[model samples]
Target: MTALSERFTTARQEGRTTGRTAAVRARVLAYVGLTKPRIIELLLVTTVPAMMLAARGWPSFSLLLATLVGGTLAAGAANVFNCYFDRDIDRLMQRTQKRPLVTGEVTPRAALVFGFVLTVSSIALLAATTTLLAAALAAAAIFYYAVLYTMVFKRHTRRSTEWGGVPGAAPVLIGWAAVTGSLDWPAVVVFAVVFCWQMPHFWALALRFKDDYARADVPMLPVVTTALSVGRQSVAWAWATVAVSLLLWPVATGYGIGLGYTIPAILLGGWFVVEAHRLLARIKRGGDMKPMQLFHVSISYLALLMVAIVVDAIV
Candidate 1:
């Protein structure tokens, strides 16, 4: 009888294990979707190497991995919260009208629950596995985006992209702090690079979706500005990004990279400038605006630029 009871217990345990595995896989994929993997992939491209550079060699593998996990969770939570908050408006925008919540694939309450659980789990994990400073920064980034940017700046201002840069820049700083245990000049440089990079990147996107944004009453820069102004703003931010990136070499001793890094920065920055100028010229000539082209190029440039930083570190 005892042997029979134990066999039944073992069988029950095996079944539970299988069930848990399936449940976990589904939840993880859902969470990954919330993170917007494409965007998080680009964001993490900056994070790991920032940690490596801060350590001035290789970062601690455990800490780096933990920070990435926490950062991904925090970012995903923020995005989920934003989707829930903007479900109504998102359903009205062409680009976002088909997201999980907007399409009724996920209920708003479910999204809210997911966001809360992910947010709490992220903060707890960071606090346990990494420095509190890193954890705090992660939380602040989420709050900045979910509350400050999503709720306030995005709905209220023409320069929402500029204001949103604050949170967008935080991941770099969070990665740096995770390894260094404090904010420093190197972290500041990384933050500046991301901040300046976001301005043009988002402005280009705004140009592409100006009508969607306007129809949604989101108050994006392109929605309120003339094409000439959008072009000029793009040129200005792109130039500023290039200037800021070059300054990194002199700011941190770890920043020295061969002309390989400089070459791409200059060429890409120049291309961005030319595109902006061409857009302005097109506006003047009454030609079609290639906002989509500029928008896609901007994404490529930012991702490649961050990859360049990591490559420089490795080489």
Candidate 2:
């Protein structure tokens, strides 16, 4: 009887422990989902290439992994923190109402704790694996997105989208820091490419979701101007993007990114400008497809352009 009772107690304890473990796992997945990992994965596509280029070839696989892990954690923390900051506004929109914070699956206090923990942990990890500069840049990115963009610019003016470029451009900076342990013209070129690329891409999304943004009283560029004006701005930026990317050839000391890369970059630029023009035309006619097309092309352009950069570095 004593042995049987002891066995029964052991089984009950195991069951209780299993139940708690399951609950903890569920909660952790929910938090990870809150980070929008898909978006961060795309951002990493930009991050790794920049790091590789800055290193002038392959970098330490171990350091690269650490940087990537730290970057994902930092980016995740930024997203989660942003969700918490915008919880009230998120509840007001269809696009965001299902967020863990908005849906009460994760309480605001819990989210704040989670985000802070991730942010601190990420910076610590980066510092441990790389230089303090990498950690600092990562922290700055978190600050720019979570505090500057999410808390301030997002609530203030229509130009908020433009100001939010800081964080968008940061991955390149982080990439450069991770590899070179410093910043330079090549890093600046990469940062400019990504920064300029975001204007049109995000503004198009803003255009499509104007009603949602307006409903939330979020001050995005599209909400303040006609679609045509935004398109014109996009085209102007696209032109600038093409120009900056072309300049990168000389900057990287012709790192194998010659006419082979140049031709496609120019072609892509022309297409972007044309799309921007089409967006302008559509707006004049009170339509919308062009902006959307330009948005999609912009994504392709960035991916291809980075591929060319990597190829150039390799050759």
Instruction: Highest lDDT: give the candidate number.
Output: 2
Tens digits of per-residue lDDT, candidate 1, 111-215, equal: 899999989998998888988998999999889899989999999988888888988888888898888679888678778888988877777777777889888
| CA displacement after TM-score superposition, residue 125 of candidate 1 (Å) | 1.6
State in Å the error of residue 13, model 2: 14
TM-score of 2: 0.90
Local distance difference test scores for all models:
0.80, 0.84
Considering every candidate listed, which one attains the maximal TM-score? 2
Instruction: Give the Å shift of residue 57 in candidate 1.
Output: 2.6
Clashing pairs in 2: none
In terms of lDDT, model 2 sits at 0.84
Residues 172-227, candidate 2: write the lDDT tens digits: 88888988788888889888988887888899888888889999999899888877
In order, how many clashes per candidate?
0, 0
